[model samples]
Target chain A: MPDAGITAFADWIATTSLSHLIAQKLWAIPAIQSVHIMSLAIVFSSALVVDFRMLGLMSTGQPLSAIARRFLPGVWIALIFATISGLLLLIAEPVRSLPTWEFQGKMLSLLCVIILTLSFQKLIAARAPAWDAMPGVPAGAKLAALVSIVLWILIIFGGRWIAYHAG
Target chain B: MSITEFLQALESTAFATAVREGAILFPFAESLHVVALAFVIGTVVFVDLRLLGLASRNQPVTRLTNDLLPWTWGAFVLAAITGLSLFSSTPERYFTNTFFRWKFFFMFLAGVNMLVFHFVTQKNVKEWDNDPVPPTPARVAGALSILFWACVIVFGRWVGFTL
Candidate 1:
């Protein structure tokens, strides 16, 4: 089936409608764009802080939990922006974006990131003693963090290129 | 094959077919690109601002950049690859696009700007040079760096509008 066919496959029916509805709402488009940028700031800044820790360049001495606690707010904040921005963008042109290849690739990678981040939260970071022990970051934990970081990076680039793709 | 042919080769392949078909796979790729770009650019701006004395004044410039360099490089490398991938799908269209033309062109200048910063100004940091306020030359370079990146983003944003 073609891309249009896939959207009509019943499973994608809800997603299709949601995208169309959002795209049609004129006021929502710019609002989401603003939110998306704000969220991006939080996400990127917070992640870089952790990345620095992973490489052992900076030590706050407060522990990984503390750092994570502080930055997590940022992560969530940025995520909200991303979601809102994405939704609004989708709202503007659901059928067009719904069928595009870049849009699908972005979604798949996002799923992989979400799963990894949630699954590893406890194992990589839960077992520490405050400033004394810090988070007992495992190799796997660091690896997960690293992967999450890299994937997010790719997602943004791809997202920007979507418009170019259509042209 | 010509360079253009090598790049456009993807347009003629199954991937392109799937993309044209608007499969789930294509949208996912596009998302990844946007996310990566924000991370990379955000990181670069963060580091660049620190260099120019915007924030992170207590930290060493050399350390700031060196520490974050890998992430920056990672972002750049991935952005370039994905960009090439994107270009592959529409060689002629992009080749003729004014914004596309400026994007690659400015992207090149930004890369050069980065290189010049490291080689030229980075050398002075180790010599007990502390400038809560950057010196004249450093300030100039810093100003230039900031402007260049802003253009990179501005031009990048407009690429969509114009193209």
Candidate 2:
């Protein structure tokens, strides 16, 4: 984020009723936790389906496009929840997280994954055969998929590592 | 007593050096452990969602399980071996660690929950063979798997903090 963007976000978070809402009760914390946990299943469900298909577990006859169409919604939903709950968790400890280089690094990687997800949708689903068939997914396409999975795994590892090396 | 002595006392059968040095083996067992986790967690999420009516609208539950079962066993093996080596490194802490204990409890529940799904619910699977939605037993198993896995992850996270 730009310095201006950071300043603006901090201002909005501080000035809004969101601060008071999160502060109102302890139950809110667990609610945030539940959202975080539930989203894991959703996100994993979507990714695994596509990965399974890629690995040729199911829907082999169906084009990769159809299989991806079959599961991208859950991925989006989980990303949304993961984003919201993640933001709430970060807000709960912005003072500490803001300067934490690990947090910053994770955010950067996440940005890369999201950009890749958007930039290469057709390529990702290119296996589906519904697309212009672009001949076949380039090596670049497979690299993007692998990169996406690695990013998610790294983020999870980073999240777990945060407790140990919070700074 | 020293940490080494304490860990040795918890599981006296093995040499402390042999046990704690799991990273030394760096062999097939370690590789299997990782592959197993991918299978177990990966299939669990997919199958659980199907229980909740999430994906693969036309696929059979049996077929899905048959495809994924090998991986689950793989994960279970990795977790078991790594878990053993992991415990050997710090048995005393794990024995008394609240989070570690809860993780064990949840892991046990996950196992039993899975077993119940196989034995009690296996019969009912055919009943819902053509049905898109699984029966309540399968749904309950799915819910428990999610809850149990979540607890396991939390405990795993908390272990790093508390220990």
Candidate 3:
């Protein structure tokens, strides 16, 4: 049950001019990696704050909606930068990335996180005000926060492992 | 003793020796370093964004800083501890790495930037505590803080790859 289309896309990415430029330029990889890590900090930190709020950890004085409103936009922006940087890195070394189990895990984790993040955003939009008014977080919100924490840790670990175990 | 001797001696200490030799412990420390990084920088970004009048506009700057500083400091302590452990494992390498020097330089600048903001621009914080856009000096400090921290993260990562 291999996906021919996905494999073909990966092949095309490897042969692209953009990939060649990235691989050949010494500064390009480090510069892109620097931006990638910075964007990672921004997105991950923003999401961590929201998750903490959900778990009743910090910023308890502020409305969850207010905190989310303030941080989620930055999260979205940073996520975009991170994705582009990540794509460039992957394309530049498609042979290394495409065949690695850790890379596959990282991609799968990222996809799951994207889904979870969108749903969490919707949940925050609809219920954050109520949750803020309540004395304690509802069980469901806390559960979602826990799931987010686990998923994010897995994603981070997968990212690190990919480097150590790259093909 | 020479600096080299000092670093080599430090590297051979029980704690440093244990961290370097322990399979699980070194990796665990690295994970802590990353987690602590998120906590420390994330909190600083929140405060800096507020100072720049880019986010949390309705909230008073002082209150926002007060709320976030405690967490920032707590995370920083953890980061410092783990960072020191990592350094001790290979003190001479970090000492000689140019990226490491640049990382330290930016970290020092970030500290000075914070101190200047607190002692100077923050003297009349209440006057524009809720201003959608803070005064020029506060905004400058915020902007500088962001720049310094960004450099710190960049060079810090560079040290990893270069070493």
Candidate 4:
């Protein structure tokens, strides 16, 4: 069983006016969901390219910084959208959302994803020129890419299960 | 057979039975589908963005497409497999859903958009391959492609909720 604090929080969210409005509106959930999914595509696609480069899978001829500079804007923009939509979805039905194991798991993965992405970006920025010249990226960089991929997969896994598990 | 019959037949198959009935299988397939979609759309964005003259301003278009298209094709195949699996689980519902229809229609358009670029504008690709911005035709193809795929993603997500 979840702790008492989580249950109380879930109870409080269940009574919110926003949650009631979301439940009443026919189009609200689907519209928000569409935006969320599109944001997923944008964020994942931009990150996938950079990660692919880190893994030595593609863009072998280009420097890491060169490719990253091209795609990071898309990533950041999409991430902002994803965060907003995700929060909207959460507030729309936090009672249903908060009690679920899927939500709990998704939050964990999301936390890891943010940390990994930020740190990896920092690492790339710090060693931009040196990393670009190397034919093979550092082992650490590849490991970060792999970990980021795995965390996202976990996020997707938990996300797809949220509805099924939600109270 | 009628269209409904066709879809029903698809859903009635042994594979579909497993997909629909197996608790773990459906969600697992969904996760796979999301992963594949990320790769397909992600790689395609590079080509589209480059054609738009938005990113990778210095890279040759041919070089970018050559390096990226292979991975895109690979991911496309994976997406098709996972997508088919998802469809099989609820063929009748999906067949009737407007969102699903829009998704496929836009997917077809994206395919045609790519073909036109490959066969027509790409014929003279050598002339503008190194140009900071590609010519009008190439840019149009890129822009249309981005539009079609964006619609595809929007519709694909809507299908889940609508169904």
Candidate 5:
């Protein structure tokens, strides 16, 4: 459950003019959500490409660093767009968004995945050539890739469940 | 029977009713649809960008498309199946919705663009396989693909609102 302070903040946000504007405008929420979903498609797909490469599922002929360089920047850039749209959604309905366990879980999972992705990128930057020279991807890198994919899927579930599970 | 009657029947079927009224079934299907769509669009965009000479310029177009097409096809099948499941739940509602109809229109355009590229434009892929910039027809196809898919997503999102 949300604490008193969080509940108070949500209440205050609900009373704001922005919330009222969003509530009155039928197209606003869906428009914002469309942007959010499109950005998420870019981010998730980019991450999948890098992860698939790490797992030797595709593009095994290409160097890992080359593939990561091509796709990982898209993940970060699209994430910025998704976050901005998500914040607009939260502002529009703070009470519905802030107090939900599903929302909280989504944030936590997002944070973990971001950290995992960053560390993976850092490792690649430092040692991609050494690892790429090896006959196969290391066990640890493949494990991280699997974890990254799972966390991303979990985050997607949490996002959809928020509306259904919210108070 | 007429198309409308067939859709009405589909909506009233036991499986469709179960999906419509069940607490989790609809949302689960929607989430799966979204996941599958992300991969489909993502993989398609990657290839399109390559064709447009916007990204991954170092990699050969043939190699990139060949590697990514399998994931794209696999995810596209999942997306279509889940999309059908969602449509079955309220067949008439979706069938009559303007945005829903537009979504299919754009999807059809995207498919035609792909087919033209495969049959005509790509007949001589070897001519420009390794070039940083593909020929004009290939670039045009890539641009059309991006535009068509963008329309599909926007219209698809509007369907939920209009529904």
Candidate 6:
């Protein structure tokens, strides 16, 4: 259960005119959600490309920095879109979204994945030349790639579970 | 039996019932479907952008496609499986939904677009693989693929609302 402070905040948001407007509009939530899903596709796929390169599963001949340079910008841009649409969703259903464990867990996982992705990018920037010259990518970079993949999958699952869980 | 009877029977099956009524089964399947779909669209978007010369301009088209095709197909298979499972859970509802019909129609178009790209546009891939921008046919295929997939996602989401 959410604490009193959180519950009160959710209640207050639910009663707001913006929330009321969103709730009254039948197409609003689904439209926002479609944008959210599209943005997620961009972010997740871009991350997958970078991670795959780090794992040496694909594009091994290409420099890691090159792959990162190509895909990371898309990831960041899509993240901005996802965040905006996701916030609209939250504003539309504060009571339904803000007080739920699934929602909270999804948010937490999202934060961790974002941090992990940033660190992964920094690691590539600092070590790409050395790693590219090696016969194979370093184990540490591969581990980070693996962690990033798992965290993304978990975050996706968490997003779905939020709908299923009682609010 | 008639189509309606068949659909009713399918929906009444134990597996379908379990998926529809069970606490976790439906959501689990949906989550998998979404994840798999994200990868499918994601990989496809990367290739499409390459075709349009919007990104990865230095990478050869054939090499990029060769590298990403396996992941795209792999994720596509997963999405299909999960999608079928979700459809099975409530056949009649989806069958009656206009958005659901549109979703499948767009998916079919996407498939046709891929076939045309592979069998027709890509016949001369070697000629333009190294080019920053692909040939017109390849670019058209890429644009159509992105549009079709976007329709698929939009209609797919609308199905839930309309149902």
Poorest 10 consecutive residues of model 2 chain B by lDDT?
A: B25-34
TM-score: model 3 vs. ground truth: 0.90
Categorize the docking of model 1. incorrect
Please identify model 6 stretches exceeding 4 Å from their true place: none
What TM-score does candidate 1 get on C-alpha atoms?
Answer: 0.60
User: Model 5, which residues run further than 4 Å from truth?
Assistant: A134-136
lDDT of 6 by residue, A1-167 (tens): 54788879988988899889988999998889999999999999999888888888877777888888889988899999999998888888887777777788888888988898898788778887697665346787688789888888888898888777763
Interface RMSD of each: 4.9, 6.4, 1.9, 1.9, 1.0, 0.8
List per-prediction Cα lDDT, in the order shown: 0.61, 0.64, 0.82, 0.84, 0.90, 0.88
Q: Provide DockQ values for all models, in the order shown.
A: 0.17, 0.19, 0.48, 0.63, 0.76, 0.86
Residues B1-163 of candidate 1 have per-residue lDDT tens digits of: 9867765676788766665566454455555555556667666765666666775566666655665667667866776776655555566776777866776777677778777767886677775245555656665666676566555555555544444
Q: After superposition, how far is residue B38 of candidate 6 from its true place, in Å?
A: 0.4
Q: What are the runs in model 2 whose C-alpha is more than 4 Å off? A: A1-38, A55-62, A124-127, A130-138, B1-6, B9-42, B72-89, B154-162
* B103-131 per-residue lDDT for model 3 (tens digits): 99999999999999999989999899989
**What are the per-residue Cα lDDT tens digits for candidate 2 across A47-124?**
655655554544555566765765776678778988899888767645445545566777887788667665655565
Model 2 alpha-carbon miss at residue A119, Å? 4.4
lDDT of 5 at A154: 85
TM-scores of all predicted structures: 0.60, 0.71, 0.90, 0.90, 0.95, 0.95
Residue B20, model 1, lDDT? 52
What does candidate 3's lDDT look like per residue over A1-167, in tens digits? 25565567778888999899999987787788778877887888888778887788777888888878877887789989989999899989776666667777877878887788788788878986588775446898788788887877776666766655622
Per-residue C-alpha lDDT of model 2 across residues B1-163, encoded as one tens digit per residue: 9876766576665544465555443223333333345446656877787776666658777766665666567657777876666566557777789988898899899999988988888776888865688888888898899889778756754664566
Which candidate, 1 or 4, has the higher TM-score? 4
